[model samples]
Target: MSAHLLTHGIIHSTTDPYAQALLVRDGVIAWLGADDSADRVADPGDERRDLDGAVVVPVFVEPLARPADARDALSRGTAVVTVLAGPEDTGAAPADEDVQTVVYRHADRVDAEAAGVWLPVGTDTDPATLTGLLTASTQAGEQAYLVPDGGADAGPAAQDVALTALRSVAEELGTAALGRVRHRLVVTHSVTAEDRAFLAAAGVSATVVPDADGVLHAPVASLLADAVSVCLGAGPAGDPWAAVRSALSHPDPDERISARSAFAAATRTPLRALPDAPAAGLSVAPRLSVSAPAVFGVWDADAVAVQSPDGRVAAWSTDTRAGTPLLPALDAETALPRWRATWVDGRIAAEDVARDARDGATPA
Candidate 1:
């Protein structure tokens, strides 16, 4: 990733705005200092990008609109902000806009206790054909259906009805539409706290910002951030565990192991550890034996044993549960538990020894 510096702009960092310049490196904000102090802290090889005195507010750049810009923003550690506009209001294509608009309408109905429905229209089909298609689809279990130009024109009353119908359909779908359609639900105003909690519990990300009147701002940031996080495999705010899980599932085994290890360390939950003698006192060194591939195992007072598939026995302090594996500890002199002991052909490797005292040869 290329490093750059954005200078002479009103930059928003979290909740505060600063007049100083921000040094960006590898897509993160490396330093934020006064413009005059740039020479003292700025990297010599960084590319300087002047903001032309514009207020550089962070806006969530959509992948479809301009992916490179989004990448740049993420690299710069910019907090993505989104505007909550109804899908129909956004003027996106018909097919692409339905899901978003449906979600928005459902949220609106829930907030205002109104009714709504999805109005599907074919761009190339005439009014009669559109109505026929809608009728057929509705008969085939599609609810809250409407044909554009056949039901009603775009108006407040018509919109209300449409929204109400859409909400009904959403309810019928039982939240499955959310996953299937990839729609985002954003609350644009200060809703009841109970509603907010409900949304959060439902795994819907939301942001509450205050308006000029001290009212909470619409949750545009949440919606945009959700989209960005989904694409980047980063979890939404207030949910770091999901992101960690995603990192653990990375394709690269090394990355997956590293992520799992980090997670285990942070949570104080020992995962599979290498088999080795319990360290002196409270500290224990896990070692992988030469006879077995390094594997994950749990340590307790009784024993340290290898997990299934890769079976290597190491010393254990006590009995513990077998969960995930942590990072592998490497040392030249110490022999660690072989994780791949079980995978050694038809019989266990000659050097591999079962720590009967610890686990009693019980396969984890």
Candidate 2:
């Protein structure tokens, strides 16, 4: 058993935005609140450390990662990842104890849910079989996902086929039954306005990669405005922050997602896309609250702010009244905040070499 008392840091929790301390015991959060009250819950043997105003937020989740990129993702503070692999490629995925791996296999049809990840429906599946597969998965308490049949080059054609297929399945299942499953769609390209409406009406969650081949392929801001539950996915290379940056810095200001939205897409939103995630059953679903897994990243940033999607509003702000947790200022031209450390299940999994040496501690 181990106990660590982390004090004097910002906890990015909606439950308590002002929480200044967090207590971790046995790889789970035990308590978190103001610094003054933290001592009451602290034990003499607990390892106490002053956070010195660092920002602590839930660890990042890479939805469409490659197995070979797991180590790179982990070092950058992504503890939870969904790796898409072929049936034979499963063995290549990372098996690290500190990393939570969800493996989705690509096949002609929706196979059984794998050990950790949910199986995805292929585009070639017929409507009748697709309906049956989705219905069965829902009935069995698993929400299956669909990988749409299109890429950046397909433009509207790819989305049309996917929507048509899903529409047919929805008609067969009835709207309510289909909604109960809370289906997810992995979109590779931008969708038409009509398709976005259909996605919202069907209650389907969409995961989008903001950029492909150095160009913006999706209008993320427009999708969010239409009430679509959009999450960000960093394919293969596992650089989620890069995706977040691309979402924030789109050339078309009207299509740019805010820093808050972009950050959530890479972190909190991906968890909702996975029902079997480690944090799925937590009381505070998207917060660093007690009884939740101690999965979070500690970073050194000048300040955190709610960035406006509107180009007119200042790119960054430090106003406490924003009612938002402080995050690193995501200036497009500047480097992102320094990743100080990453904690998974209350254990330090990775740390910056320079910071470790400066603090006279061993690098994680």
Candidate 3:
């Protein structure tokens, strides 16, 4: 049975236009419209999330493959997540998120065989193991990710090495798409043309990620256009929202884009590179960006539902419902109290609150 999360007053959506209310099911937006219409069509047993005028946006997510990565992302505002490995320590679901892991990278770092089908193609890898993994995944119809700057030493995946790997595969099969080569890889420290070309020959694409600094630049920004997408780095500086801010506020005025486009770069734009990703989304948040003047200071913690593929929904809406609240946007401090009454998900889950017993042990 599909569920629903009805929100009214304001919405900043990508797929659906401004409406009084919308529906969510299986963690994805399912319907959008006015309150009366939502009431008329809503099936019984659907979850009614009144929000109490507080915002209710989709959970913002960050993609990664490590436990340490999740710990860092939660500090920022990454809500939902798409990770490569499940939690090893706390079962804590971040403040408003659910963890979705894919493959676990080896903690040992230098273990090339540990990479398996998702091969990290940098100089640090054991040449024989890397070659075998790539060849096997190619023949088995499984997707193989080429991590350029991955390995025990953690060196950037050399552009030359990546291209050479692809060239060998392409020559062996006479085509990049043949022998189970679907065309894709995951790169670190930005991407270069030769790397993109080698994978392109096999009809593969890549996801160009940033270094610890949280920046994804062009050619990496420009070359991997077809199937390439940028990640909001999962390192300490990795914040998807920050990634949106950066893309929207690119230093060069000529390169600057809209808040919505920056968001796409964080989530939707990466879809092309994620041929293996689920049809549903990862992390989602309603609009509360300083990038849009009207939405600024709103602190509308809720997310506006939107689909980047359509490029139609308003980033901010002007139409207002007659009885909407006239209250000022709540700050983080005040929001906590009201949350107790309306925190639909796990209220005491790992991160909501923690008692720091170590601080005042025995009344010291």
For lDDT, the strongest prediction is: 2
- Residue 182 in model 3: lDDT: 59
**Candidate 1 residue spans exceeding 4 A from truth:** 49-52, 60-153, 170-364
Q: State the local distance difference test value for candidate 2.
A: 0.69
The digit string of per-residue lDDT tens for model 3 on 224-290 reads 3534444443333554444454443343444444444555455444333443444244233333221
Which has the higher lDDT value, candidate number 1 or candidate number 2?
2
Give each model's clash number: 41, 0, 30
Q: Candidate 2 lDDT, tens digit per residue, 162-193?
A: 56666776676766665666667777666778
Task: Give the residue spans of candidate 3 off by over 4 A.
Answer: 1-5, 24-30, 35-61, 71-97, 104-116, 124-129, 150-157, 178-184, 188-198, 218-220, 224-234, 250-258, 269-364
Residue 358 in candidate 1, Cα distance off native in Å? 79
Q: What is the lDDT for 23 in model 1?
A: 62
lDDT of 1 at 241: 27
lDDT tens readout by residue for model 1, 134-240 = 33333443222232222112223332333333344445554444223222222223234444443333333322212222222233223322331112212122122
In candidate 2, which residue ranges exceed 4 Å CA deviation? 34-41, 90-93, 108-142, 148-156, 212-215, 276-285, 311-322, 358-364
Worst 10 residues of 3 by lDDT: 290-299
lDDT of candidate model 1 versus the reference: 0.29
